[model samples]
Target: MQLAVLGSPIGQALSPVLHRAAFQALGLDWTYHAIDCTPDRLASFLGELDDTWAGLSLTMPLKQSVVPLLDRASDTVVRTGAANTIVVSDGQLIGENTDLYGMTQALSDAGVTTACGVTVLGAGATACTALAAAHELGCDRATVIARNAGRARQFLGPAAERIGVKVRITPWTTAPAHLEAELVISALPPGAADELAPLWKPAAGTLMDVLYRPWPTPLAQAAATAGRRVIGGLPMLVHQAARQVELQTKCPRPPYEDMLTAASAAVHQLDTTT
Candidate 1:
């Protein structure tokens, strides 16, 4: 069966590598590819596909746009209004959001305690996922910082209401305060995050940078130097992709180690290519 990940700037995605490795380990005959599809061209892109496509992984601008195109979706997808995984069954498209599962699992695996505070950077779709994840992780108080305050407030309002977390929205120019929370999740893009490093520091708890590429982002490096625990975005990426594989292939559990190794190798290859 054929499966693929779709996004505008999708060439950098490690999904194909991880999914291919899982398929190989499970002895499943499946091929996965990444396609660069922007929001304007998404309709035409979907029109070209047929039933032979087993599944699709949506990213960036398409995550929200693809929702209307799906025949059905899980409750979480409806709640989040976004989809990262699309399962094709008998020509029907079923959308699901595995990003929350991935982010939640990563926080749990990192031993982040319940009822803690969380500070998240960015107000995009991934940041929304992080907000949901923080709530699921038992974070009662959360703050979302974005380059644009209006956009941040808009994206965070519904999620904060649904999750019942005290959500605060602020401009990215304001430095994040080290409050009572023990975890800080950087959900910003790589370039933007690099610029924000000088203004932020992880105090007493773990700092999770949601960028896997470039290995350790500047924020992570700064946090590490400040004697704070650090978690990379790779764990979330692997876990989320694993959940997608399970949903698409009906596998009981994902081959985690194999996927991680493959993702690492793929990143290494990318580094060499550049």
Candidate 2:
């Protein structure tokens, strides 16, 4: 069978390393690869897949875009309006979102139990998952920061309701002087949160920056400097991919250490070069 992660500028993705390791460990004769799939090209690419194609991991621009292409989506997808995993079964494409689980696992691993208030930076597809994850972590209220207030409000409105969290919107440029949430989730792309890093001061809690590459992102570094517990996105990425593997292969318990080891090696290689 075949599986791959699809995204733009996907060459740097460590998904291949992780998946290949998992397949080898499980003795599965499966092949995993990465394909540069831009938003405009996703449809053409989907059309060419055959039975051998098992599943796909969508990233960035394609997460929300792939919604319409699916025969059906999981509850997470319906609520978040985004999907990261698509399983091709019997000529039907089924969409799902393992991100929420991944995010929850990451936060739990970082020692976050129950959050009364959650603050999320950036209002994109991933931010939707962040909101859902916050709710899963027992957060009653969520404050989302986005450049465009109208767009943020519209998108986060239903998502917040579905997650059972009261919603509040904040302009990106006018972030509050004191962000005192029990947990702060930075869902912005690489480097996007750097400039605002200094402005963030949490009375207590952890900071999770959803960007793993380049090792210490400025935001993460700043958070660390402030003596806050910091979690990078790699653990979340690994966990989510493991869920995808379980779904596609029907292996309830896929060996995850192999994947984490592979991912760590790739991160080490990147670290040495930088």
Candidate 3:
């Protein structure tokens, strides 16, 4: 079977590396690659797929954009308005979000099992998943800091409600006020929140920056320097890709450690080469 991670500016995507390591460890002769696909080309790309394709992983702009193009979507997709995984089951295209699961697992590995209040940065599709993960971690209230309130509320409002969390969306200026939350997730893309790094307050809560390529993002660096626990996006990326492998291959035991090794190596290679 074949699978690929799809998105524009997919240069930094490591889903293929993670999934390839997963399939290899599972002893499956499956192939996973990365494709440069944009929102406008998503439909055409799906239309061109053959039975050889088993699953797809989406990133960035393609996550929310591909929702309307799926034959069916999971409840998480319905509520969150985003999905990063698509499984070609039988003859139907099924959309699912493994990000929430990924985040919880990633946090658990970092010794965070419960959070009461959370502050999320950059309310995008990944922020929706961050909210869901917070919910799973026993959080009932969240504060979202985003540059665009409309887009943030559009996706986060219903997702929080359905996931049973009360979320308040605020402008980026109010971000520092909520730095004391039990867990703060920087769902922003790399470098997007660099300006706010200088404003990062020393707090007791953990900070999870959802960008792995450059290791310590400015925000992450500030948080760490301030004595806050920090988690990079690599572990979350591996966990989510492992879930996608399970969904696509029906493999009960996906080798997450192997995938982590491969993903870490790939990230290091990209970081050094470019």
Off by over 4 Å in 3: none
Query: Regarding TM-score, does 1 or 2 come out ahead?
Result: 2
Q: What TM-score, over all chains together, does every model reach?
A: 0.93, 0.95, 0.96
Better candidate number, 2 or 3, judged by lDDT:
3
Q: Compared with the true structure, what per-residue lDDT tens digits does model 3 show for residues 254-273? A: 89999999988888888888
Q: Highest lDDT: give the candidate number.
A: 3
lDDT of 2: 0.86
Model 2 spans with C-alpha error above 4 angstroms: none
Predicted candidate 2 versus true structure: per-residue lDDT over 1-274, tens digit per residue = 9999999889788889888888898899999999999989998898888999999999878998999988889999998999999999998889999999888888888788678878899898899999999888777788888878899988888878876788888887666643556678998888888887786664557888888887689888878877778899999999998898899898899777889889999999988887
- C-alpha lDDT values of all predictions: 0.83, 0.86, 0.88
lDDT of 1 at 252: 92
Q: Sort by TM-score, best first.
A: 3, 2, 1
Pitting candidate 2 against candidate 3, the one with the higher TM-score is 3
lDDT score of residue 109 within candidate 2 = 82
Q: Which tens-of-lDDT digit does each residue in 1-274 have in candidate 1?
A: 9999999898688999999999999999889999998989887877677978989999888988888888899877876778999998987889999998888888778886563778888887787787777878777778887789897777678867765678888777664464225777887887777765665443578888889989788878877877778889998999999999999999997898899999988888888899
For candidate 2, the 10 contiguous residues with the lowest summed lDDT are 173-182
RMSD, candidate 1, Å: 1.8
Sort all candidates by lDDT, best to worst.
3, 2, 1
